[model samples]
Target: MAKLPTARIDKLLSSMGYGSRREMAALAKAGGIKLDGQALADVSDRIALNPDLPQRMRVAGKALDPLQGLVLMLNKPLGMTCSHKEEGALVYEVLPERWRRRDPMISTIGRLDKQTSGLLLMTDDGALLHRVISPKMHVTKSYLATLDRDLRGDEGAMFASGEMMLEGETKPLEPAVLEVISERQARLTVTEGRYHQVRRMFAAVGNHVTALHRESMGRLHLPEGLDPGQTKLLDADEIALIFA
Candidate 1:
């Protein structure tokens, strides 16, 4: 069997944003770090780093946080910027403050403008983030759009033609699916994450999206009970659905 990865307890704790290395030493002295039900005598002790660590390790009397490859599914709220530096409300504010400090910080896989809301993904796994966002993956994203005016019946055909090109864009968009819910509301599914693509698509046909909310990415839909601004850690099965 392969040797399990190992790291100094203080280093691991600090990397997880529990505290700085010096702080971890103090925490260990105060009986705030434990492994396998025993308080650690030294913060410098080496420990196996594996999936089971969360269950076997305790920090400040609580189970350790999820390990490095964390993925989160969030119900994005309107008016929240998906940026870390922009002003006003930020999506990261909904997460535990310490998570923002994690080494290899969590970042949204793709962005949603402040005006849009719905299913959004964040991950610390850089490869996974890039895989889902890669154009070659063609991961489908579904959106529900409330429009400013009635739909012209041709909107669906136009979108599905694979010939639609947003203004100022050189390449045609891949064929998209548009399911009309009403004269003024529609659900659109797209494979590309171009800047404001959904909104731009509507504008191309002389209509405007009054409200836009993402409903799904591939087979993963936003949980109906997940309120705006709330988040859930995606498990292995849920993560697989994005590639399904």
Candidate 2:
């Protein structure tokens, strides 16, 4: 097998937003860093970084945080922008304060407008993030939309026609699935992440979306009862479901 990557203990902790290198050194001196139940005597000592590292090492008496390739699912609430510099409440604020300072900052795989809510994926794994968002991936995203007017009945066929063009866009959209729930509510599943696509789809048909909530991405449904703004770390299997 190939060797695992390694980093100086202090540097690793610092990069993970534990503290500055000086703080890590002081933490080590106080027996706050440990490997295999023994205090790490030197902050300068290097250690292999593997998936199991979180199970083996303890920092300040707590297991190390998930490593760089971490991915998480957030049940985003309405009114929070999926942005780093937007003026109002931001999705990042829901995460631990220190996580915002990690070297490889976590970011949303795609965006949900401030008026929308529901399943949102965030990750520090750049490659995985790109893979999920790439147009070539055709990752399906589903949303529940509550509209201001009753469905005109032809909306389903229009959306699935694969020829509807949103205003200001030059290309036709891929075929999307529309399942009507009530006169004014429907579930829409689309393969693309075009800006405001769901809401725009309704507008193109002369209706207005009053509320929107994402329901799923690919085959992974948001867990039942997960409250708004709550987050769950995704394991390898959960991540694979996105591509499955």
Candidate 3:
């Protein structure tokens, strides 16, 4: 048997994007890790990936990858949770089985609520995740909201001035653009990403959001004809736009 330098399984899994280092260790302890034909005995065990050995290596019965990262965007459909639980509907449920079979697990950078649907970015790249979600970056997210009522005159001014109160609190939002699509619809652009912010901001301005859809995050727009629940790989330019 050709012996390869061994490292802790948890560390290997973390570097492979399986999960964070801490989470991967916990999974290994739970008998969720195996190597060769035997259950993993030590989280720190150095295992040889000898090609000569049958069942050379596996994690949760899945082969491990030593290179490459996965990234993609999904036009998430409403009603799917963002969690990874085996039961109940989740965004992963909509992904093909082949994707789920990959060694490194993909994770969403930021999540959309089950009731709200639009573009969502998922990747195994930890640095990219931090760059997009960190508040200091101030990445703008544009959304189109269909409201139950129309906004005119003072209502339109209120949205632009950032004077809306969210959840009865008096904190002003960043400058936003509100354009009337119709008497009952509007397009809103915001730089701050608060939880349920679009809905709350509209509600604070006395308009109830009936349906909300995110059109873009930063400069990356949902590609034309990407139906709900569809996803496509983002190219270098598309990814760069999000940070730019």
What is candidate 3's lDDT per residue for 1-244, written digit by digit as tens? 5556655666766656567667777877877776656677577766554433324667766765433245688998888888887456799877765456445567787888888888898887788888899878878888889988877546667767756667756677767877778888888887777788888888777789988888888889998899988888776788988877
lDDT of 3: 0.75
How much lDDT does each candidate structure score?
0.94, 0.95, 0.75
Writing each residue's lDDT as its tens digit, candidate 1 over 58-90 gives 999999999999999999999999998989999
lDDT of 2 at 142: 95
Off by over 4 Å in 1: none
Candidates in order: C-alpha RMSD to true structure = 0.9, 0.8, 8.1
lDDT (C-alpha) at residue 75 in model 3: 92
In Å, residue 191's CA in model 1 sits off its true spot by: 0.3
* lDDT per residue as tens, model 2, 1-244: 9999999999998989999999999999999999999999799999999889999999999999988999999999999999999899999999998889898999999999999999999999999999999999999999999999999999999999999999999999999999999999999999999999999999999999999999999999999989999999999999999987
Instruction: Tell me how candidate 2 scores on lDDT.
Output: 0.95
Ranking by lDDT: 2, 1, 3
How many angstroms is residue 19 displaced in model 2 relative to the true structure, after the best TM-score fit? 0.9
How far is 107's C-alpha from truth in model 2 (Å)?
0.6
Error of 3 at 140 (Å): 1.3
Work out the TM-score per prediction: 0.98, 0.98, 0.68
